[model samples]
Every structure is written in structure tokens, then in C-alpha cells.
Target: MKIRSLAAPFRSSSRNNVLFLSTVFLFMAYATDAQHSAKGDMATEQKIHALISEMTLPEKVSLLHGNSKFNVSGIKRLGIPEWALSDGPHGVRAEVNRHDWAYAGWTNDFATCFPPGTALAATWNPALAYKQGLVLGEEARFRKKDILLGPGVNIIRSPLCGRNFEYISEDPLLVSKMAVAYIKALQSKDVAASVKHWLANNQEEHRDSIDVTMSERALREIYLPAFKASVMEGGAYTVMAAYNRFRGEWCSENNYLNREILRKEFGFKGVLMTDWSAAHTTVKAALTGLDLEMGTDKKDYNEWYFADPLIKAVEEGKVPMSVVDEKVANVLRVMFNTKIFDEKRREQGRMNTPEHQQAAYNAAAEAAVLLQNNGNLLPLHFDKIQSIAVIGDNATRKHCSGGLSSEVKALYEITPLQALQQKFGARVKINYARGYEKQSTFREGNNSGQSGSLNVNWKLIDEAVAVARESDVVLIFGGLNHDFDTESADKQNMDLPYGQEILIQEVAKANPKTVVVIIAGSPVQLAGIVHRVPAIVWSWFGGMEAGNAVVDVLSGKINPSGKLPFTLPVSLAQSPAHALGNFPGSDLKVNYEEDILVGYRWFDTKKIQPQFPFGYGLSYTNFSISQFSTDKTGYGKNETIQAKFTIRNTGSVYGAEVVQLYVSDPLCSVLRPEKELKAFQKIFLKPGETKTVEMPVKVADLAFYDESKKAWNTEAGDYILQLGNSSRTIFQKVKISVK
Candidate 1:
């Protein structure tokens, strides 16, 4: 099982010797299979095994760690090429130095910046997720990158998680559906998608060492589904281990999570690499199924845990040689899957093409959720408006290059102010005012130079009010920037920072026709002005075309169809983790006291109302659902419950609606959420158009993880199918029996 060393004459003494061995291996490989077949092909696996058999121990060890900052070492004599990786789930990140974190200053590294994960999840359209992934894959390949470390599927456990913008949702099913689509599309372009932060790295506070504890039920039901689907369904090529600990063990070396769950249960055959400097041990990590140790702060490459230390461990019998072989096998498998050996045949992806920009625009335009519009104040008519007041700091701030790892060097970013000026400057007199000032700047792992002054600047507020009084319509773009919603640090609280509440309230008071657009990636406190503002829109960090997407929605060119992926609680106290007093925990340990009830589950189960429920969104037009019914009144556990409904666009405009199907088990042996989203479909319609939608829910999917039985159990009982546009707005309910 151990890798055999080269013969004495064939060693690396001179270039001629190395070239002789490379020619011999290449001839052997071609003789075995002239056409290197695809992955899972018997010929391909045989070629990989043949190559591994000839690789020396030193060569195998080199492949387990980085030779450069973002590259895995390759066997030069054997003609194996190095593997290149990049940061970004939404776009291909700009190139950095070969040995450090500094930018490489390459002009050709610019990429198409698409909307972030939260925005993609809000769309509830897996098709858009696939489209975004296609663009990301093309750009990653254009940069000659083998892997794109993205489509972070970690559940949004809390609203304050610094990286919530990079995650999909609070619910596992929703996360799984979106992740599978993103992964499949990315890999289709021959670029591997590294589904990341494996195993419950939910919160960023104390992430490097905080130990997370949760029930097996919670782990199986609320956390593991998305990762499972990514492997089994998406056929993901790689997984990035988290920086935290799960159940008191570092995720990179945790045997239970990596060996038992990911490798054995889900049958993942891909490489499991560390999340930057996440590796801590050598033998245990390798034996426990870790294939690659990507990044560590060690100045010398040989000092890395998976480099010299790993080879020494194998030589001293501290680690088995079979484990090293296994790791190499995984790496080789990815190389073959991505066609590393056949570069000419691989995809020659183009970067920042018009098609790529269109995909980015599609995601941004479809992901803006209109949270409130009391008197139809939105879809602003340009003819009726004489003077328009645009206020806030976010209106002018560019968001394409702020966050640390996810930053993209976009060709150009269209700010809201710039977009508005380009679209409507001649039609209307648009006056601008910086109603609030940013009090902090984000610097990767540190939050330095943050101002402590929370007091409202009366001077700025008075000036904004005066501008609002003179304008016929005021659009206040107020929300968080990268200073608050970023990686490495969670928000201190859910409050609107930098006197934004006072500024928004004063501006709204001066002009009753005020529309507030919250431009942020994560949830923020909206109770301050939810009632005061006549219109409210939740626009996420909309990548390079942020302003264009928001303006399109505001002008009725594109209807707002995006929904809330996670529950927006009225206050921090109403959240499950906070309500149980166990967030970010004490003494470096956190408990999942809320158990399986993470987001809307706890709110609905405890009868606590959220400000906006999961899947909640408003449209410029109206949608009506009727004739909701199930195929049968009873079915076996294996049968599919075909739920059919009729939806119509009742307004005088084109729009889309997400039809959500939730299941309820009123009398389960164990406590289940009041309702769990089993299936959903986003449907588009023209004015007065009716479409019949059929959503199928399998009876086995309704099963809860019965901890007592150590398995999922679908009890034979009466279940209710509730169909609606959102989680809380059920229009019809039909009862079905599972036997």
C-alpha cells in the first residue's frame, strides 16, 4: 500500500534523469489507456492507481500541502500539474502573491461580481443559483484556477453571524437545494466547487477554537442535510473543512464528522481540504480522511503539518502508509475529474463576458425583496415626481471590494447614486445628501478604527430633513456596510448603527413619501422605521450591478420576487439561540439549547411571532392561490404526496411567486417544528395569467430524526399539507395520512 521509491539511477540527480523517468511514466500511462477516460471509469481509476504506485513518499507528502500560498504541490517528474484554488463563492477572487496575502496587481484577474449567497437564497430559484455558478466557474477557469472555494452552505444559525451573507439559509432543505444546483453548474465547466465551512462553523466569534455542542438530532436534521446533498446529489469535487471544533474536536481532524459522516455515510469520494490555516495535527487529520492541508502561517513550507511532519510520521510508523496513499488517491481523483492532465481538452472558459454580466444582473434583479409597501408607494412614476431626494452613505459606497476573502476586483461597480444618475438624471432633478456617516472600516480579521460615538449628528440630520422637505419623493438608502456585516467578527447587536435610525426617522418625517431601501447582506433591526417609512425594500449586497438591480425594481421594470431565507425576528431576544441564553457561549463552549429549532422553527413552535417569517416577500403585483389539494388522503411512507394548486397574477403587471409547501405532524412522538418546508417552486406569470403548479413531497421526507431509535422515523399518522406563497401565509390546507 505504500508508495515505492524510484530506482537509484532514476532519482532526481540531474535533469536528464528526471526527464527519463517522466518519459517512462508518460509512455506507461499512454500504453495503459491512450485516451484518459473520465472519472469513475475503470481505465481512469487504473491510471490513477498506476501513477500513485510509482510516486515516492516525498512526492506523496508534497501533494498533501501547499507549495505556494494557494497551490497544491505536484509531482513534476510524473507530470502531475499543481492545483490552483481561489477565494470566492460569488466570483473568482483577484490574484494574490504566490507566497503572501498581498494582491498580485494583475489587470486580467478582474471577474464578474455576482450577488452573494444570501441574495441567491432569497430568490428561492435554484436556476439562478446555477446561472451564477456557471459564471463563477467560467471566470475561475479563465484565471487558470482548478477550484473555486465557494457556495458556502453553512446554515445561518444566528442573524449576527459575520459571514451570514456568504451562507444560504437557516433551513437545511433550502440550503441543500441551492447548494446542489450551484455545485453541479460549477463543476460542469470543469472547475471544482469547494462546498465550504464543513460541519457547523456557523458563528465567526471565537471560530478558530470555540467548541460547538449539539444533539445528534440537531446535527442530523438541522445541520447535516446540506452537506449530505452536496456530496451525494451535487457530486461535489472538494470540501473545505471548517475552522472551528465540533463536539470538542477540531473540524479538520474530527474523525466522526469526516470519517463516519462524510466519507462512510454519504460516500464522498472527493478531497477534504482545510479552510486556510485550519489544520492543527498531522497523523490524526490524515487518518481521519483529510486529503489536503491548504494553509498554515509557517514561514517555511516544510514546517507545515502535512509536509515534512507527515513524511516523518509515516517513516516512524506513527501514521500508516495506506493513509498517505488514500489522501493521494483523493487528490489524484480530483485532478482527473477536472482534466488537469489534459489541459487542451479542458474547458477554455472566458471571463467577464456579456453573458456572464447578464447572469450577475439576473441574480441581483431577482433577489431584492420588497418587505413593505403600505400605499403602493413603490414603482415610482417618473412623470409624477418633480424633485427626488436620494439620501444615505450606502447610496454612494461601492461594495465589490470590501469583505476579506469574498472580495472581487470587478471591472466596474455601479453604485446606487451612479445608477440613478445614469437612468433618471435628465428626467428629474435628483438631489443627494449623505444622511449618515460610516463609523468603521473592515480590515480582514480585525475591526480597528471604529468610532465609539453613537450619538446622532444633528447637523447632518437637519440638512437631510431640509432636502427631504423640498423633494417630492425621498429614497433613503440606509443599511449596513462591510464594517458591520463582514467576516471574522459578529455584530455586537442587531441595532442600526451610526445614527441611521435617527437619520431615517427624521428624513421620513420631513417627507411622508419616503421609501427606505436597506442595502445589506445580513438582517438588521428594522423596527425603528418599519412603521414610519411608507415603503421598505431589502436589497442585499448586489455585487457589481447593485444599483442597477435596485433601480429596476423601484421603477417597475423588474418586479421584486425575492423572499427572506431566514426568519427576521422582531428583536434579538425572540431568536431561538438568544432566547435560550446560549449564543457565542461562555468559556469557549457553546450549547445548542434550542436543539432542532433554529430559525422559524422555534418561533412557530413557541408561538412567537417574527417581524417577517421565512420565505416572506412582497411583489409589485398580486398573486392568488386557489384549488389547493393533495392527490390522495392516505399513502405509504415511500409514496409521494402530489400537492396541486392554481396560481394567478391578479395585478396588471408581470411578476413571480414562490409557492412553498410545508408539512405538519400534529401528534408526533417527538417534538417537531410546527411546520417544515418540504418543497417550493418559483413561478413566473404575466398579468391575468393562471398557471397550475404541482409540487411533490415524499412521505419519507416528513420523518424526524428519532434520537431514541437512532434513526429517522415517519410515524403512520395524519399529516397536513399547507400551501402558500410564504411560510406564514398559508392559503389552503389539506390533510393526508401516512401509513
Candidate 2:
């Protein structure tokens, strides 16, 4: 239905008539609940109850199911309009434009694309995540979308998880903080932020039928923290249950997950929708807290497992009328708060606004982590080089969108070749070659009857090598693409796919001054010839202004400030899940055998050195940390510790340093990681300038989950507070006794 339009008041000449007209307008405002007061929310709550009381049982059932593929039903008699939803986290997706699942090519649906979640997390800047949310939300509001189904808070337990590119981090604390920031910004713009995949949805393999079995300690310590913050702290209005079964029941209808935890514990008063026909039974879904069922059948959205069966169950006395009313009421509350019935309508949003474009550029620039710079070869001077060689398929292809539903029809994308040419027009000559072809899968558009993309041209690699030999310096753009990183099945291995390793080795031999700019979502294995390269940098799937962001860092226009959110292992076998022989279970079961020790935790605990540790990244300038101390040497379990340190930019150029605080428990009841990241701060400084940094350490931060009691316990012992830039690069330590 179109938005309601009100007629203009008559221009009467008489003062008495004008006075009467003004009174009518005031009455109309009060009637529509337009002029809301400070206590309006309380009144709105009462209105939801009142509306529920008036609705018939059939009407209530319709509200709890999808009215369309992307909308919920509303009662026209009560003047309640259906709410619209869009796919999100990164960008307002192109798919949401259509009434069904097909794309509509709607001009108004065009949106400004932002950097991926993995890239945003790589920055280690929650503030940037907030900006990402705000920009994406603004575009969602323009598209007339009420709810954004996004901010997938699943931890990247394995790099090979095809959908890992969409997740934020391997650490729960970082993911929680980042999730909250994004949720707040999105909700502030009147768009409901939907935090998704409620439980352990680590792998896409056997997603629908797989049984994820794990201890309670692991769930509380790792998986559930981010979802808890999303509801209790971030005030997210919607949550999408995962497709996998947590224990024996599906997540959509799991009583403990949907009721005891989410609704009762976290106080989630919003809607809980299933992940596309994930609901197995009507009785469990109705009795539990599953509110709305969407996309169970996208093509024929008219039919739903929860819709007809639910009404029948309610009439048969299996389900109560009160349960149906609660679901309908929750949907109504979201509609009320989002201003769906407001008198004025918002104008359609245009794509590529200056502010939105700048935010995208800034995120990509800061997210590029410098892994290695042996000779300080970066911050390259264009004047010193007469000609430069740029080689790879990634340079020519568009990288603004990828990874399942998060892929976007971006307004425009600036390729690395275009950005480089724009930077050095005629002063420095730039030559580009199609180094190697990245294989695109059927779903990702290739190599089958599905899309027919096949061709591994060694000739192209040979041409790129010849070009590298001629140029003074070379930049190789290579890594995973949409084909390698998508939803459905996990990637085969961590090695750069399809002979890119061979291509990089040949290019490096041709030009010794080769700097490999990796464009992967997760850590890639760079063992054999990677050490031979002078400089190595990892740049994730950057959005619209990625090309510009890359050039800005290379030309000394912007300094690299990003750090690794997850640890980079030497090989797949070294990883915790893989080492335990627990990943990709044979009988449709994935075990959490690592048991709260993931990523850096696994490597640190085992004393196994990684390719690059977590929190590791290099800047253009050097920095030193000193004078580390704590306010107290002893503290009670209830008290907090304050760690103080001084960081100075001890170099000739301005740069930023990430001050990471980790807790080291020497003696504990259970085995613990050597050092777990508790807090981190990113601060910028001028050359030769020093600043004092203080990070407050909560006592709860040092606690371990006691599985026996199902509680977090902080044992009395000597705890070490280690301050550093990265996991392996500890600068100083101050021991404190906790009693």
C-alpha cells in the first residue's frame, strides 16, 4: 500500500473558521499518535496490547508469518502498515528491491556500498564500525526498509568456512563490541538492526542438518556473548535464528535458546524469525519464542510451516491464544517505534553520496594491515620510479561486492588499475598485465553448466613476469574471490587457490622488489616463497573506494593502522579445529573440540608459533611502549585493575599504534590460554611524540567458565597484565595478585 497522504486545509477568510481548522489539525495529530510526548513509548506499549485485544485469531496468525517475501502482514482496519526488511550488514542488497526473490532493477533501490564486516573488524576500531552502520542505515532508510537482516555475529572459528568473509572476528569480546556499535548506529537511524544466526553457525557445510555439539562453557565463553550484547546492550529489535540444530532441536524452535536465554535472560522484547524454512515443527515453534517465520518458501511465500499449522494448533487447544498475541504484539511494537505511520514520507535515497563514499574510503584505508615490510619498501615514492608494473586478475575485476546475500549491485566500483592510473597520470608510467585467472564457481558465476567460466592461462602469467622484469618495482594483486568465498560449502584449503602461489613465486623472481598485496577475507597460507618477498600486506574485500584506499596507503597519503583480528596459522593442520580432527564431521556433526581455545588462543596455549600472530600489523613509522605499571598489585575479585603505559612514535613519520592489553593467568583451576586479549586502543601520534594510555581491566574479564557450576569463576591467584601491540610482541608486564 502507498503511504497515507493528507489533504490541505481550506483557505477560509474568516478568523473563526481558521481557528476551527487549526483545532481540527490538532485533533488529527493526537488521533494518529503523531505528536508523541516523553511518555509516548509507554502509551505505545498500551496501544500494542489494545490492538492485540481487538484482532481476530486468524489476523494474529497472519502477522506472525510473512505477508510477502520481505514483509509482515498488517491490519488495514486498524491502519497498521506492513514493515519492509532488507538484507544487510555491509550494504543494502540488490535483492531486497523485488517483491519476490528476483531482482527488480529499481533505480530507487540503488545504495551506497560499504566495506565488508571482516574488513571493518580488521581495523580494530569500533568507531569505524559505527560509521559503517550509520552510512549503511541511511541508505536502508532511503529504500523504505524498516529492518536490516544483518550484522552476522558468528565467530570465524575456521578460515576455511566459506562464509567467514561475512563474520567479524574470532574473539567474542571484539565481536560483541563491534556488533553493539553497529546496532546502535543502525537503530538510531530508525532502521531496526537484526543480529543474526543466534547460536553456533560456524560452518556452512551441513548447515541445515548438522548437529553442533559443544560444552556449555564454550557456548557461554565464545558463541553467546555477542548475541547477548546485541539484545541487552545494543537494543537490536530483531534476531534471526540459525539453520543448524543446537542440541537435538532446530535453533528456530529450541526452547532453551529462544525462551530461557534470549527472551527471559537477555530481555529481547523484539521479533525472533527463523532462517528460511528452518522451522521443523509448529508445536515447538509456537510454544517457544519463535515470533515470525520468513522465507521458508521464498518463491511461494504464501505457504509457511508455521502459518496454517499454527492456526489449527491454536484452535485444537495445543497452542494458546496468548502465545499468538505475543508474537503479533512484538511485531507491532517494532512498527510503532520505527515511525511507519508518520504523516510525512521520506524521500528516496540516492547512491554514492559524498559522506557515504568518504566513510567507505576511510574504512578500507585503515583496514589494510601491513604484515611485513623488511626494507621499509612501502610508502613508495612515485618520483624515484620511472615505470611501475601492476599484475593480477584482481586488478581488472570488481571487488566491491561478494559473499552470498551480502553481494551488492554497487553504484560504482574503482578498480586498482583505474586508481593507480588516476594517481600517476603521466609523471610515472604504469603497466598492467592479466597475471592469472581466478576461477569463479557456478554459484559465484563459473566453471560449469551453471555459468561456464574456465581458463587457466599460464601465458598470462608469463606476460606478467616479463612486465615485472622491465619495471623498477612491482605490485601483485592476488587472493580469494567470490568463487572461493561464498555460502554453501567450505573452501578446500587455505592456500591461495588455483596456482596463484606459483604465479607469485615467478613474479617475485622476475622483480626482487615485489610487494604482494593480498586481497583475502581470512588468513592465507604464505609459506614456501612468501618470505622471499620484500613487503606483504593483506587487504580484505574492500567496497566502493577500495582502489583509492589502496593507492592512498601506497603513495604515503594515508598510514596503515589496521591489525589482524584473527591469528594466521602456518597451515590448515596447525589450526585448532583441524588439528583436533573435529572440523567437517563425517556424520553431520561439528564438534567444538577446541573448547574455547580458538585462533590466537589455540596457538598461544600450545606454544606453537604462527605465520603472523593476532593483533600483528606494521605502520609506516615506528613506535615504542614503556613505563608499564598497574595502580595496585593486589585486588579483590569484585574490584577492577587499571593498567597504565606510555607509547611514543619514535620515528620520522606520523603513525598510529594499537595498544593491546592481555590477561595472563599463571595458575588456574583449568587450562587457559597463555594470554587473552582483554582490551585494545588505537591512538595516533606525531613523530617523536609520547602519550599515556590507560585501559581499565574489569575483574570479570579474568574469570574462567567453571563448567561444573555453570558459572564464571575468578580464582585467587597471581595474574599478569601484559601490554603489547600484538599477541607475540609483548612490550611490558605488571603482575597483580587477585584475591
For TM-score, the strongest prediction is 1
Question: Which ten contiguous residues of candidate 2 have the minimum total lDDT?
Answer: 1-10
Model 1, 22-69: lDDT tens per residue? 778878887667445433477777988999999999999999999788
What digit string (tens of lDDT, one per residue) describes model 2 on residues 336-400?
76767774644244455899989989899999999888888997899899989998888767865
The predictions' CA RMSDs to the true structure, in order, are 11.2, 9.7
Off by over 4 Å in 2: 1-41, 95-99, 298-302, 345-351, 444-456
How many residue pairs of model 2 clash at the backbone?
A: 2
The whole-model lDDT of each prediction reads: 0.89, 0.83
What does the lDDT read for residue 427 in candidate 1? Answer: 86
